[model samples]
Target: MQVSTILLRMPNWLGDCVMTSCAIQKLRVTYPDARFILVGSKACEIYKADSLTCIIDESKTYPKTQRWHFKKQLVGLGVIAKIKAYILYSLKFWQRNRIYATYLLAKSIGKADLSFSFNNSFFGALFLCFTGSKIRVGFAKNARSALLTHALKLQDSHSMHQVQKYEFLIQDFIEPGLFAHILPLKLPQSTQSLLIDDKQHKHIGINPGAAFGSAKCWQKEYFIAVIEAFLDQGHYVYLFGTDSNLSWQITQGLRHMSITQQKNFINLTNKTNLTQLVDSIAALHLFITNDSGPMHIAAASSTPMISIFGPTDTSETCPWNEKIAKHYFCSHRESISKQSLVVESNIAILCKHLSCAPCKKRTCPLVHHNCMKEITPQEVLLIADSMLVS
Candidate 1:
């Protein structure tokens, strides 16, 4: 059947959405005339060039009732009341708007001739089913095989990165051997010129907050140490984070520096939106971050990066361009499992001795984040120096 309109259900997280860029680019190349509609988070707007119609915000379309319930239970237990209350209020707002958003999404989906879901969740499959597009395609996981007209089996190996996994799913629809040559992600050129003094000065971007959880975040003390080391070496530092409280804490730590040092450090936490964040990252000489969404965004921008990893599987979620970034693992399992996948020339893996790494917990199960603590800032700085020099 000739496909005139294609509706793609994009992955939820910003990092996952960035990883889907290559495959989405491939689909655009293969189906140049077909109209494309992307359904995912607002972050998916970054892929506006490849898409034709509009982006469906998943946060509105699929309300996070399970998370709301979990947090409400936490609030009842009197664990961090203030924070939980704020989160609960936000979730309630989303819940109120979800039905109307879902109605609009259903109406949009009904117009598509074919639908594809990059997401592996049962809810994603259900959304495709609701589209009633007859030609729904997606991975047959979460017991959603029945919902998809063409359900591909999930790959069993953990060796492949998420971007490659996305490509594997997209290959079924395209001609043989064409998926291998898809172009890498490139953001639109910035209209406003970047306001910086000297282009020759090395600008290092530091992202201290990880939205997934604190388990994925390295110690703030360690981040401060790295920032100090860079400033001492006459390098400019730009701290980036989405969390206002965390950003303020980091900013306060550097407030006592001399005027020279203060001038070299810039805190951009909670300041820029998604589009501006990309533009800012594109101007950086290097970006050092935890395993977060911006790490993938920086990687897609082709900015050199050093990503600190804990608990999460690096083999599954490492930056797509291995040749341009270094990944430091906190656990032995990640170091061992991800060693073979690392690009020897551009990528290096660092790990300290830890038995409980790859714990895969949102928060540390043992109440100690030794995995992230043991990795010293000096060690990271040495590697960063080498990467910059080379």
Candidate 2:
């Protein structure tokens, strides 16, 4: 089909949605004039910066089941101990009322020439079914194959980065050698850069929270130390997160609040929405982040960053760019990573290699939680110094 209007069902979480960009970039290149209608939450709204995209805010419509977040319900619960909890969680999916509601929601989106879902849930597949698109494409997981016109199998055994999985799906649709060169696309109006305030002070952003869970989070002491160092160096530090409560949690209340009250510190935790977060990160001289949603956004903004990693596999979810692609994602899984994914040669990635690392768990299951704790503040500050200057 000569697709003119494309409907995209985005991945639920912010990071996964951002990872879909490379494939989407290819899709856009293949059909530059296509009208892209995105079905997703706040993350999808970021696409507003693009000229040819519109978003449907389904952030509150259905339960998000990405990455098996249901595991949170199973935590610390035995077979008989939390039967009600189990039943309620199960009902959230299998309930007939919600199913019908999903159909209604899907039907309302109207039609498109082609529709593709990066979302892995049944809701994603079901949405495609009711959208009445000319062509439907999605992964054939969770028994949703019959609904999609093109159902690709999950390549879990290959350990492909989520970006690669999307690219592999998109490659068939993208004609062979259609474009002379494939380049990484950054967020609109962003450049590989450092922003100086008043031509004197450099602005930096710190996101101390990870939405996934504690296991993915770096220790607060390191964050505080890094923030302190930035302030001492006469740099403006902005704290970013989804809510103000996170600001309180990270700052640890009154004493720290007073310390951050200095003009160099701006607590933008509750202040910026996802769109605003993109703009803020793009404006910063440097961004220091844990492997989280904001980290992905900062990466997309083409902002220089030092991304810290722990339990989550960096292969699956590193801050990606075209160089990273040629260096790692495009290569065999067994090929050793030289860690040269840095765009503009200014990105820094810190991942401590431990046998127990990349467990992909929400919480550290061990005594020491050594994976996150071991990444010191000194290394982060060292990276910050270079990013600020560059």
Candidate 3:
């Protein structure tokens, strides 16, 4: 039988979009020549376009108010006319492809079994179902499962990591099994060219931000402490983030540290594109990151890493490659709320004393975030020390 079309309803965020590349990989293996279409938010185009033939940018169609634009005064009739024209043009394009079912990548978005109705956001699944695809695939989160001809049980917090979990959903369509083999991401040529020379440096990559919000981030002081230790050991540190202010703060803190050697911290925030960023991460000997997108990227690239969990469960989102990732969960399996994720693990020298930990606050709901504050830099340094020795 010929596999004709595949439409994938991608996640809204950049990180999830990147992680879902595993699904695309499985699709390629099963339907090598089939038309692969991706329907996703506009921000996702840069990451998903390389993997799919067509893209439907939801952001362009559903425009959100811009913060900068809000302060500006509404211009004259001429400006209003241009805005209306643009809106009209975008609507036309959106409606042209609005039929939904004719979408090429309709593999897993249908099936009432994975209905989004319960979640009240099953529009993606509903679109796939109405698109009239024969083989639709998606996670059944609600009563909408009835619409899905091919639906997989949606994995929860205690389930396998996101990559593995999603692979299970798509693997049901093809032969053999999903996640039977490791998923590998090919580094872009641009990223290949910008590889850092890590021959001598005990290169450590630090990502100090999480998209989930500040609640997920480890303490800044702890990060600085870890960097200081790396320098003490004559190692080079690479700091990455999208925020310029954050990059500056990290670099400034490192420069001010009492290390004897010259500053070895390289801030690559806003400097590299997604591909280069991945390549840079892949080049690192060891990477320490919060539970974030690049963490998934590192896992996909097979880079050895230590992911600090907070505001999220590791079981559900930990890096897929077990051999390469060492996750440190702060909470027990049962009480594994976001707070439990950030409490420092009691791993020997990295241990701390605090019965009142894992507070799990975005801004310290109590106005004091002690859980993250108490997790000293020495704890993380100990882990990095082990990685360097290994």
Candidate 4:
């Protein structure tokens, strides 16, 4: 099969995009010479180092798809909100993504040999259809199965992690049993990881913001308590904030600290690009974060990390674990980790097991986000202490 080009619409979020690396890695193996045209938001910056990848910056590949954007519109409106949510679920209203997909044929891309999407939206399926590729692939939800040449059913992957789901899609649909491996996410070869040379205190990062929705975020008080502990123990605290408001909130919580102690709290929010962010995170002694983008990046860098979980299920989206990763292995990634000592990853899940919990909703539909709130700072700190000492 002379596969010259692959048009891949990447997943919207940083973490979702990162999760697809294993599949892309396998695809690269199946068609080493195929040109990978990856399209996404600024989140696509992570793929910049791949020499064969053609990066396309298109944020509206699906618009208003953020959970917080819909949470406010559908929370209490009853039947009207449910109707709206249903419509928004497939993101069918946004024709911009479809239009962009259609225009790709006119550009240097011409016609792709293979077109696929990590996004499972109805509009996402339609986008692939507009590309006019010989082979289009996606999940067979939103009644768009008729449009795809290869459509994988949703139920078959209900229990699969995002990484495995993607890898399976490639192996089953594109190339059957060609390769049986799920390699850990790894950034492209670069100038090596970067960090300041401060050996006096071990560096630990705290990311309090969750871009998905408030339901996915732990309590601010808990984050403050953990940060205070890190400072008191003579460790440098790296505070990561995506927005200025979240950065301010973290600062307000730490106002009680002395100026000298506060110096240890370094804020790297709204600064640095994707590459810098990855390098900075790779240097950390340990990373503590909500189930957010940076969490995935930390996992890729092989940094020991603690990922806190709430409404989201740990089984699907937990950070990379050396123990769990080897179980889901592939050829190229099998030969590594020869070191005698390794600092692996851990999870601190604090869901009350409420029926409504793990709803995977952007915000809590019940108005009481106890799942995330119930996660105590003490519990997270205990894990942090153990990771630091080891």
Candidate 5:
């Protein structure tokens, strides 16, 4: 039952990858001597510790081909010839890529005793099967139960946090009582120190972009108001996000602020990578963000955060550090009043008729994002002020 060489297929998104850190730590402790091979996206770089023997960057491993270019090149050919050319090119393209991927995967997972896939997709199961490990473990959903040597049933409740859901994959292998003691997610200390001259002022990070879509994003004006509130308190504000068009729009809004406001605010959107983002967040006194990937990253960093939730289910994706942090749900249950209220001992539900929320739609199907729009900046700023003071 001892695993000598283990191949772990990680989740794809940045937030989910962050959540896997705790589970990975548990596995490492459970199999102290096992050699670990990680197959994941660029976000998985955060898990590259001494215990990891190899990391297969899934993004780089399967490079995307330019099928459009081939189509354009064959534009001058006869209709039949073009059709024939397209078919031939498509087959050759897939065959070549398949061979390369298979070779790389085989090399990465050579002679593995066990393989675990944290992803629940059919393709993830197929990847584990192709690794040729003697024992393959994964969730039994997506009709991939037959592919796994040991398949755990998916948790039925949508309220279960992803961290707990991932732990279900390896529960049978570890000791009975060890699940409750899973390690907290911790980022590796940076070798290169972050230099910031103003140590006197408190630093706050604001993330306005959500990778899921605009439906999860709060208004840019609301973000600006929050940033201004922090600046007024003589605190430094740092904006975090990826290099997307939406991030650029948010950055541009910040750029047009007064010279004094610009001096206190720093726009780091599109600039920092995952490692750098972790280091930058680690330097913060507080973080205010949407229910996005960076929100989860800040949670893992153990920063004091206030996550604004709209459209997405807070019970499922609320920051794992909810006890230490606070979340404002832009939603309302049937019996709750229109105003924000403490429904539970620690949790607060904020909104007017959030019946439209937890819609899970990337964009509002009704073309009205009232769920997010209804959340006022004053309420959020008030919460941030209280957390910072406490």
Candidate 6:
């Protein structure tokens, strides 16, 4: 198969984008001699460019909006004209590949030799189809499956982690004999500096918040309890976040806190890029967090971790690495706290089944979030103690 340009549409969200790294690696292994160019969001632009061979930044390649007013006037035209106008706009924008978007399309198909979109969205698949690549591949569930030359089905089982899901998507294209547990990351020197720089008294890394929403966040007190346990064990806590506002909230009660060895390292969030985040996570001996991006990174780094779960099914997206020594769940039933998957984990898990279980609601439909409230700090301590002893 002779191919010049290979275009891949990256997942839009942070966690999905990170997970897609697995697919990237598989593609690399499959097409060792081919040029791989990925189309990704602005937020992931730096990561894709840094990690992959060639990246067609979506924000750069796709038109966000037309020039000043002339573009708007075209949109007002009839449906056929409007469609023609947008196609022309896409072709033109894609051609100049210019920062601005309106260029030209010489033939029915655009520039890419082969293009694959990771997402199954109609629009995402449609846009790729519009480009007229020789081969288009994505999940079979893709809304625009008819427009594609190749589509694969993703099974509905919880047997594999989410990262593996992305890897499986590209299995047909590559030699399916090879497989990897997690995607690899190449950290830059600047990111490495953040990992090694340690003047603070304690070096405990804390992921106090989870982006998956309240359903995944364990009780805040559980975090505090774990912090105290780590302090007793002689480690300081550093909180990680991709948002500045959340970082400050994590650092709020640092000085007044009691856990003897605990110190606030909440300032590290959002300031550094993805590479630094991975490096900093690598430096930690252990990471205790809710089901979130940092948790996945920590797990990929093979850091001993205790991840809490609530609303989501761990079988579907839990940390697959053996380094995950323990997992804590509020209750696996919908009868418990619906609003919050308030749960905790540290080292080893003692009891998993709760009377009122995985309610799966943001707030308890019954108005009482008993599943999480019932779990005490002492229980987590017991598990931690057992973990250290073992």
RMSD to true structure for each model, in Å = 8.1, 8.1, 6.9, 9.4, 5.4, 7.9
In the predicted model 5, the residue pairs found to clash are none
A best-first ranking of the candidates according to their TM-score comes to 5, 2, 1, 4, 3, 6
Order the candidates by lDDT, highest first.
1, 2, 4, 5, 3, 6
Candidate 2 Cα lDDT to native: 0.73
lDDT tens digits, residue span 1-390, model 1? 587888888888888888887777777778888888888777777666433555655534245654566567665465578677768767667445555456556766685677888888876777778778878888878998998898987656465667777887878778777765535555553633232668778988899988888898888888988898888888899988888888787778877778899899888887777777888887788788888888888777877778777777776777666332223322222444535224345344454426777787889998888878877787788878987787
As a whole number from 0 to 100, the lDDT of residue 311 in candidate 6 is 51
How far in Å is the alpha carbon of 366 misplaced in model 2?
1.5
| Model 1, position 178: C-alpha lDDT score | 77
TM-scores for candidates 1 onward, in order = 0.81, 0.82, 0.71, 0.80, 0.83, 0.69
N/CA/C clash count, model 4: 0
Model 6, span 1-390: residue lDDT tens: 666667777776655666666677676667777776655554355354354543434434444333534467775599898888778766665444332231222122365766787765765566566677778877777467797788777665344556667777667667656553334432222345264356554355677676646655666666666665666566556777765665554456444565343333345776667667777777776666666777666655655566666555554455544332122221232222222232233232222434444455565555555455565667655544554443
User: How many angstroms is residue 313 displaced in model 3 relative to the true structure, after the best TM-score fit?
Assistant: 0.8
Q: Name the candidate that leads on lDDT.
A: 1
lDDT for model 5, on a 0 to 1 scale?
Answer: 0.71
lDDT by residue (261-369, candidate 5, tens digit) is 6788777877786667888887788888887777777777777777777787765676665332222321232322233433332223444448877788888888888
Candidate 5 contains a number of clashing pairs equal to 0
lDDT of all predictions, in order shown? Answer: 0.73, 0.73, 0.58, 0.72, 0.71, 0.57
Regions more than 4 Å wrong, model 1: 49-52, 58-103, 180-189, 192-197, 322-349
Better of 4 and 5 by lDDT: 4
- lDDT tens readout by residue for model 2, 1-390: 677888888887888877888778888878888888888766777677676465564424444542146667668988886787667766655433446656766777788887898887887878888878868888888988988899998656346766777666666678767432345535554342322345577888888888888788788777887887777777788888764666775566324544534666777776765566777788878888888888877777777888888887777788876666566655353332234223335567788757887788899888577877877898778767767766
